[model samples]
Target: MEKYPLKDFMDASEPIIVEDVLAHPRVSEIAHTLIASGLRSFAMVPIAVGERWFGVIALGRNEPSTLTREFIRSHRTLAGQAATALESMRLLENTRRRAEREQLTSEITARIRETLDVETVLKTAVHEIGHRLGLAALDVRLGVDKDLLTAQSETKIVEREKEQ
Candidate 1:
């Protein structure tokens, strides 16, 4: 029943079935609603990606004893497919982010090598890195070994030490 505590069922990695929701001790609050809806049985199968549980797939029917061994086996197959799909999507997202980061690094390095003007190189680096990383702001230090260190941002530049 809807009022039944899900913690007990969800904690297990195996499939669980409640053949008669109205007869369950924890479903007293929602027994009336369950009867009204003609829901007699329900089953839940946990979906996990790697070692963590992502969610559950629930099956409900009007028959009092619908969730049998065969039904549970079928639900397990479905749950496995769902977990595989989720893992594939996660891998794809991670691959995309890594590719983007690599491209950003290469572009910045190329730009720096192509320019000898320190101001132009710094500005290009800030703009390219910010747009690639989707950042609101960033700061880069220039002349780290010199007495005068300058910090550059997308909008402005500040000198941190006395100018040479």
Candidate 2:
């Protein structure tokens, strides 16, 4: 469409009523096309999210008619309601995503705390993460070097001797 005046109105987050498309200064440029399309009169209301313009709702008629003050007020009220609904939906979607992430985090934490065995921890971690990500396969390589293993074993032995 006709972008000359409608676009400007939307950008400004305002309402516009054109009684005569041909005589209106803002829409005069596209008056011919508007008349050809059987749109002699039209009113547009902007849908804004907060201070920013999100979209617009327009009503058009083939017969030229004067737009009453009450009619414009009603259309503006409808647009405001639409904006509120959209914002609420966006917030709800965000909350849903955040809840999912929190649930996953809790599950992972519970799995890790379930056992002190390193092998069990690694297996459970990989399985949980892979399942959440929908991965076909997941491989976890635990590289416990020989020297580290020997040190750990020696430490365990010393602790056992002290206990005895």
Candidate 3:
């Protein structure tokens, strides 16, 4: 008896197959393990998006059944909906990241714009960004080829933010 279908459908959200166990070995093997078993048919659709492989939407039945073109078409349609949700999430994440980066850059720029000395800029940026992010460590990567200026932390300690 098979432990399960070749794959388990996660969040497939609907009953989509019908079959019998003793006749269809593939379905029986997987279903036999369950008490209300004897499923013999199977259907699955690959939830693929671009080059990324996500998952599958699957259904099983207890009689002889074939994964037909119609089932595949329906499965892929649901998979496409899942793909759309994924795309929306990805876009939202990207938007949030970009906005955060811009805000950080703006804060850093505003603090340093008036200061001619690189030392003050570095010190001010470290204090502002560190507190904003509640970061444990913040370091500026200095590269000479990129015309990046050196910004070193001052010897004086910056008092930690007050307890909320």
RMSD of 1: 4.3
lDDT order, best first, reads 1, 2, 3
**Clash numbers, per candidate:** 0, 0, 11
TM-score of each: 0.70, 0.70, 0.58
Report the lDDT tens digits of candidate 3 across residue range 2-79.
233554432333333434445544445456563265445656555656655466665666557666677667777888
Candidate-wise lDDT, in order: 0.73, 0.73, 0.60
Q: Model 1: residues >4 Å from true position, as ranges?
A: 1-8, 25-38, 115-121, 141-147, 151-164
User: How close to the true structure is residue 56 of candidate 2, measured as C-alpha lDDT?
Assistant: 81
Model 3 error, position 164 (Å)? 39
Candidate 1's displacement at residue 90, Å, is 1.1
In model 2, which regions exceed 4 Å deviation? 1-5, 51-54, 138-164
Worst 10 residues of 2 by lDDT: 153-162
Candidate 3 lDDT score relative to the true structure: 0.60
Candidate 2, residue 83: lDDT: 87
